[model samples]
Target: MTRRSITFRLLRALLVLLALTVTALLTASFWQQRERVSTAELVERAKAHDVRIVRDSWGVPHIFGAKDSDVAFGIGYAHAEDDYATIQDVTLAIRGRLAMSKGSEAAPGDYVVSLLNIWPSVEQRYLRDLPEDVRAVMEAYADGVNLYGAEHPDQVAPSALPFTGQDVAAGFLFKMPFFYGLDKTLKQVFEGKAELVKTPTGSNGVAVAPVRSSDGATRLLVNSHQPYTGAVAWYEAVLESDEGWHVAGGFFPGSPFMLHGHNEHLGWANTVNAPDLVDVYQLTINPDNPDQYRLDGQWRDLEQSTAWLWVKLWGPLLLPVPQTVYRSEHGPVLRTEQGDFAIRYAGMDEIRGGLQVYRLNKARNLQEWQAAMALQAVPALNYIYADERGNIGYVYNGMFPDRQAGSDWRGTLPGDRSELIWTGYLPPERTPQLWNPPSGLVFNANATPFHASEPQDDLQPADFAPSMGMQTNMTNRAQRLQETYGADRSISRDEFRTYKYDLTYSERSALVATVQQMLALDAQDDAVLQAAQAQLQQWDQRSDRPNRIGALAVLAAMPVVRASEQQLPAVDLRESLLKAAANLQQHFGRLDPEWGEVNRIMRGKEDLAIDGSYDTLRSVWGEEQPDGRLKAVAGDTYILFVEWDKQGHLSSDSIHQFGSATLDPASPHYADQLPLFVEKKTKPVWFTEAQLAGHIEREYRPGEVTLGK
Candidate 1:
């Protein structure tokens, strides 16, 4: 062929070859996309078991199956059916993928996950540290969540499908730290107040034995105050397996095990305890390079990772965002405007938290429970334990760090001093705990663990080193419990419940103290203030539902009490009182209105008066509304009263602030528990097969329950 003809032919052949290559690439991509499992297939696999979920009147699920894994699988499906969005959100948050789904608003959380080194711990220890049975249960749970995601394509976030067993483990690793106040510690570092890494918010838990109970039996009040609705809010479930897995208690959306509650042989409760489990070290950054930090007078490279977050700016569309996270030998490196700091927290290297909780669920007696506690996988919280044997106990529990014996650990430690770094945790036996106190009573109101029981039987601070960063503060709840329960050797069932629901703060309460100080203010200041003083003087210290003066007093004191400022002026207390009075007068034309008139619990179309106040037994949290009313948000989410007879037979009751179906307001179960919750009443908890049989409104396995179009 001529040269020109050959060139044209060569060009045509080259074009043909490129077209074939493009076709092959397109085919491969299409096949890869098709190979990814669909939602329906995942759902089908999830329903592969003969598991059954029975719902009671309040919509609480009582799951049953032939095996523990099957029961967990059912629980996953059931929980997903009610609150799949939250479950997905929690898992994604733990995986540091929330920003990918939620956008920039979730970037901080993603940053936190990376900064905390959540996944590294899990990846390093999840398999070796987690028990096989517990891993199976977690896998089943992941299967349930994946199955639900498969079946509900419309509800699933884009790129969030096919969850695996690791995702389940990651959830626990991601969330367990927050429960113990790791989030607050991170906040301290971010805000450049690293020295303020104190114990988290307080909580109350009491387990009374037969000798302490009027009915000659055991009673437990599982009262945990958390954000009313979220990943941390109380969600109740009863899991049963022929392999001996039976537990009923409040669990977060993504947890495979009950965080706190009862099994057949024993029951337990958790109160937020403040043991200093986390410490911050100000790293000496290399002036020559920002990426290297000095430790032991030698420069060390910082481990760096990019955190990709998806920020949801509008609706379905999400923008991919990335942030840098660093880690040093001290732990997660946090670079703030002030300087580079590293956080060393208890449980940072542990990943058996879920396994420990699962073992606790399967624990048959005090010994078994203690064995689980010995795992020390959980970094914080005080546990109140009681069993059918009438035994009662309390553990001011945490994986406490073994800091330098004489170092002042409460303040920021020097990053360059390698000796200051805690290398290991104090063994569980060495941790502060009390078992069967002579008084036959065990209680913890987020107070110092050294004072968890009767003064005679309480753990002494001298027993623990000051370097452990143990909390020394006592909340009003602890003070009241001591006055009420500690004063009485025997407590009646009604009285026990009454004390748990107490709305009146003691005369020496923090709120009362603030009010008293406010009343001591000079009245000659201003006209608006003098009228406010008149209202403050008439105030009674009761936070009861209809107390009028409570509104003004509480409103005024809220600012000073909840302030994050490093130093608050004493005069600000008086100012808050005056402002509170003005707020009440401006809104209601009078300083005194029933507390119920000022504080309400509203959801959808339902509005009702709520009882309780900050630190009261009835614990109600309210936020100011646009109309000047305080609306309840957290506090008093789910309340449980567990009772066991002399023969070890169990009967319990519970109530939730909201109904079981968190998603569908149209469902009858949506608000069924609210009235009972507000009335301080509880619906019977169906634990046994016979009990569940009688109360079950409907029973079905996964895929059996229809989602109507």
Candidate 2:
């Protein structure tokens, strides 16, 4: 062969070899995503669990079994039936493998999973610390999900199968810290930002004793505001087992226990509580060795590991990217452009959060419930309780760190001091809590725990150490609750429900202050601004659907409110007013459009007016849209009202922003509750068999789902 031909042939051969290597890598990645377990095996596992799933007319699952584990199995299968995709996503997120499916957008979450040492910690404590029964329930729930995945493989990710009990517990471990805004702190560190801002989102929990009720009935409002969809959204279900684990309430996608709702004798509501549960320490790195940080005047080696993130690049291709994870004596270490900082958060190395919830689910009374609370496994939340015995209580629940009293807990501390690193939590009895108050009412709206009840019954901030870092801010909902429920001496059932759906802002509300600021602006040449000011002056401070000026006032204040909540620079009143007025006129041809026209709750083929505004008791937080309407995104999602009469007979009602079939648009129950939810109405919760007798739409065992029921 000629020399030129020989060189060309060699080059061609090299190109072919490169193509073959690429194909082999792609094939290997694709194979990794394939399902390995057989459907028949999953079916056999399902058959082993003796559980019954009964779907009510509204498509809510009432799970029944001989044991709690069996009921948990039913819960898993039923929830998966409604939102299997979300469960798969939750699993992926907990596993720190979200980037494998969602691409680069989820890599940060994957990195956090490694940085926190979620898997290793879970593996260490899953069996050693969790009770045998709890582990069984978790494993059974996983088996139930596995069964569903195996049978309906098309509904889930190919690789999202064979879930285990460890995954369930890890989900709790991964998500608990973020409840108190740990993610925001991490984001600030990642972006090299200074300081952390505690902003109010939404949640309202209230408990009324018989003395406070007009008809001598104990009442509880289990209202938690979460995004209308995704991992944190509430899924409603009623679980019953022969082993005395009967309860009805909300469950997250992967959870087998009720996060909040009523058991046979009592019930509680959960609201997100912000406490100084997380501490960030600035590390002093050694000049000679980058891997060593100064602590206690000596160099300590930082623990290091590689986080191998399987990120999806495109179709059937995963890029393995390795990043270094570091840990100091304080806790997880984050190396940023600013410096290396260590985070020691509550619930760190704790895997008993799910166990705590499980114990709470089975607790029969206040004493048993308090024992569960003593676990201190759940990092943070405010729990408002009511029971069948006309008792009510409020617990501003958190695993508050026992830190040195002098240091600023809200700010970053020096890493060199070992004493600043808190190693234990205060006992639950010392937690800011109230029981059967003289005022007969307890409530929280993501507000100051010190003001949860009537002034006489409220906890004094002075009694607690300043190192606890309790929130001092009060929301409009909290102020309104004081004006409505707190002011009323004898609140009737109608009034209790009315107070929950209250659409009026308190006179002292920030919205009113913002409106006053807008009215004070110099609208010298701007006619729209002048008109908006005139509208605001005549406003009733109510976000009712029929109110015309309410739309203008809310829209004008939203920019400032959003900026304040996000810790961004303050928005100018003149600018906000002029922009809001102009946008309203453009969309509706008038500045005085009805609040209904602006605030909306829309679902598949259904668009309806929703009454409520930011921080109101009705609590509708909306997103601005191109059509000039505000679409309800969060606030007032899963609301439950439980009441026990003088005879101790329990009756409850609930409403969901969306219905039971959370993900399937084709399901009739998808948006069935939206209209009622918007109208401030509710459906009866069929807690007992007698109540559910005529409400059954379908019934079946796991792995034996009958079609066209």
Quick one: best lDDT, which candidate? 2
Query: What is the alpha-carbon lDDT for the whole of candidate 2?
Result: 0.89
Which candidate number would show the highest TM-score if scored against the true structure?
A: 2
| Candidate 2 lDDT by residue in tens digits, 279-388 | 99999999999999999999999999999887776776667779999998889998888899999999998999999999999999988999999999999999999999
Off by over 4 Å in 1: 1-41, 193-202, 313-318, 564-571, 705-709
Candidate 2 segments whose C-alpha is farther than 4 A from its true place = 1-34, 194-200, 705-709
Q: Per-residue alpha-carbon lDDT of model 1 for 627-647, expressed as tens digits?
A: 789888887777788888878
Clashing pairs in 2: none
What does each candidate score in C-alpha RMSD?
7.0, 3.5
